[model samples]
Target: MSKKVMFLAHEGVGLGHIARTCKIANHLSEKNMCLVVTGSREAAWLLKRSVDFVKLPSLDGLITERARYLGTKLYFDRGDEKAIRFRKTLAEETARHFAPDIIFIDHTFTGKGGEYKDLLLRSGSEIFIVLRPVLGTREESVRHIFGNLGADLIPVLQPKVLVAGDARTSTSSDDVRSFFPTIPIEHVGYLAGPGERTNPSARPYNILCSSGSGFDGEVLSYAMCELAEKQPDISITLIVGPRGSNPPAAPPNVEVILETHSIHQQLERAQLVVCHGGYNSVIEAMSHHLPIVVFLGDGVDPIARDERRIHSRLLSSHYPLLVCEDVKELPQAIHSSRELPAADTYPNALVVNGLANIGNLVATASPAKASDFVVTPIDRTGDG
Candidate 1:
């Protein structure tokens, strides 16, 4: 018999959580029943109907903004209060009908603002939480470590089984393990998802500029547009979030995709990438052996700024990606990166067999026994 699986993903600030959930769903769809429930406004676009998807509706009190809820973990009336109730309703609806055997949650410790407290009882399914290691102590994660007199907003959602998405090679799984010392976890290698690794080529599109989310994407898009307008000789492509974000118009020389679901395809074809540092973005870019020019948000949105910068510094040390503190510094960085020889180009060091590992995990999963399954990846060579 086929199993029923549901994934609960939150937008938080960037689309990384939603994107990660969607990638896992792809591995499950062919054999098991897969359903994805998300709160992102661009859910339809990002998910791209890759599997059975449920987009939470916008309610009056709970129409949320990333700034109010993402970092502080406090629900401000930026209108998404109904989001909590929405999560409960969606979970209940899925439980009532779909009857999942396993519920895989991405990043979100709690159901919809952690309001879906009784999810285990309601669904009667094993819970799995998958997250990447965000290095450095931020005030929000720090607050969750030490308790406050109910004033502390962000709650660390513990899982019955934690899956840390780090491989032994590129990332230090030990540091990831330290973050959740109490939880039983298994190393599942990289989180590039399915079909994200591609062969590198000397493509015509030389530069690809992207910002992962809708809010901050516009800033990067406009910057790229200005750069493209000035330099007609160099080919450029900008992936601003969705059509709703209204990416700046590009010159005839530049190609702008409102959004491209296939991250690997775009990155492999490009010679270099310019993006804000998000976990999945960094992984995918590196997986395709593309050099990255990391730029933090312009500080327009505090939540976005923090979200973009969260794991950037830690990654710069291990990965070959270059970090640019200022946007104006991007042109010279991109030019300098091109000057490097073939041997100097950063090879795709982070190998991913995430989908195969996940499949092996599901096959060995015991319904009566909930235990950590340390994934032994099938192949370590170049996302093969």
Candidate 2:
């Protein structure tokens, strides 16, 4: 029956990857065997205690701006070779021992800079790439310089099928086909609970500032806090991720939550959501049909710009969004959205019940043909 499933989630630089990985794991039928391995320090928080979860060394350190610059310096010089090697070895060992029937890699095609590429090739299990609802196509310099060429170096370059955790209407298959043209895709909906009724009258705050991980929104946080301080009458709730916790004083109207497991509760209570434009964040906000303002970043991180920009094009009259480039323009967007009527809530926009859909896709899905598996030597050092 090939019921065993193994999920390899990239190290927790952001909450979206691990969060969506575990969400799918939790929904799988109880009869199936499932194992998840992740590098985020928040691994325990990411998955339920019942699921078999292994925590590995985080690879976030190696995927930063500094690591992208490939000049006279060696690959090891750009990244923490120690951490990268350790994670690769641990992941390989874990997957080898588990001997899964199928493998699900969430977002990171090149795990720890091509760590999983070797593992994916050697493992007998069929592998699938789990993509977020919206896979950003905007290429960064690093993607152009290394992303395309690097895929060729990986042995099992193609996934058996791509499972998208978003509704088909929210994102077109064409968006991702450009990335993996031949691979088939299954839309399993946004990996979250259903949308709640919008009670603008009952909303806890007029402006809700949310993000995936606490890691990335320092400048946004500071600016939001400054905005709140400037405008005390307008209420704001910041659902700070692991990185952006510990905001300034509450100032009566402003509230800061350290981190929450499910953002649905807070999202339903928000009249306007100012978020980091993560796939999960945008989908959740849109599900609630609230006015949205997406934050790209402070220009320090390249990923901020290209990663979230692709979905901005999907914003339509039915789902109007205020794309915030800088904090200076945020207050104006918030004010403008406040005047606009609450957008129509499409509760069924995404497939909320995913276990059956995902199970059917994984169980009956065909493994790639023999030609798909090309022989390639393992890059044990993880430098390549």
Candidate 3:
């Protein structure tokens, strides 16, 4: 019988979680049935062509850096009892009807107050996969709180894999084993795979930046304007993803592409990528061997913490990627990064082989037995 995989993603804040989930779903879709359940209509829309998606209406809370609730920083609205109830009902209904063999959950531990957990545990013998980025201390504290909640709400639950995107950056397998001792940890490499390679001769300089609507776009707009002023000769391509975050009025030197599907092609020829530290964009930059300057935004989502941590670690490892906390410093970072050599890019073969291994593991294992599968991290040569 064919395996059924359900991807449960919380679209409360940024597009990173759902975007990563979509990539995994696309990879797994060739052999298994994939269904994506998300709260962000924009995320669903962005991913609709690649995978099957179901949109769950969200509480529509604006995320700010200073917000907090229940000792956790609020990425989305925390106290919408009615929306939570409605989402919970919908999740339960979906799980009950679909009866998936495995469920992949992104960032959200409780699924709006233990709703999906309740359904999965009661259903029995279903594999749960938790996808997360490698986090630092502050974010780990928040994850611990959510993990505690999951343990309390569903005692029997054990995730089959805690897929970390930063596995390539980890010092050792112990780095991952330390956090998820009960379940196996897999370093799935960067979530963004090899996209279409563009002709290198096409553009002298291509700058790709995306903030999925709201405040992120505003910040990116400011950063892009700064870059355009400093480097007037470079050709700038700004892609605004479907959240309708318009780019600021650009100087004649810059060309803004709104909601463009050709980002992969653009990134292929770009000398530099200026982005909001989103998972998909950052990895896409790395996959294409482009130097990146990431601007960390203070959004109301825990996923932003993941972005910041990933960027911080990348900087520490001298990965040739720079993070701009102050948008004013973007141009300088870009200039400095331009001087550095491109970091060692992961081979396409490695990514394909790794993902194929994951699919094979999922296919061969029984739902209840999947949790025991361990993934050995791929060894990449070079310091960066």
Residue-level lDDT for 263 in candidate 2: 69
Ranking of models by lDDT: 2, 3, 1
Backbone atom clashes (below 3 Å) for every candidate? 7, 5, 2
Query: TM-scores, in order shown?
Result: 0.75, 0.77, 0.78
Best by lDDT: 2
Per-residue C-alpha lDDT of model 2 across residues 1-384, encoded as one tens digit per residue:
547688988654567778778777776636567889886656576566657788875444444453343112233344465556666777777876676777888766657466666677666667677765554443432243125234563344456444454454344355555555665667765554457757887634567788667666777777778888888777788777766667656566777887887667777667888887876677677667777888777642464455566566455333667777777787787778766655655333445555466777777855433343333433556455
User: After superposition on all CA atoms, what RMSD does each candidate show versus the true structure?
Assistant: 9.6, 5.3, 9.7
Candidate 3 achieves a global lDDT of: 0.60
Model 2 TM-score, 2 decimals: 0.77
Candidate 2 segments exceeding 4 Å error:
29-31, 60-83, 133-150, 153-158, 161-180, 186-188, 203-205, 230-233, 317-320, 339-356, 366-384
* Model 2: worst 10 consecutive residues (lDDT sum): 66-75
lDDT of 3 at 277: 66
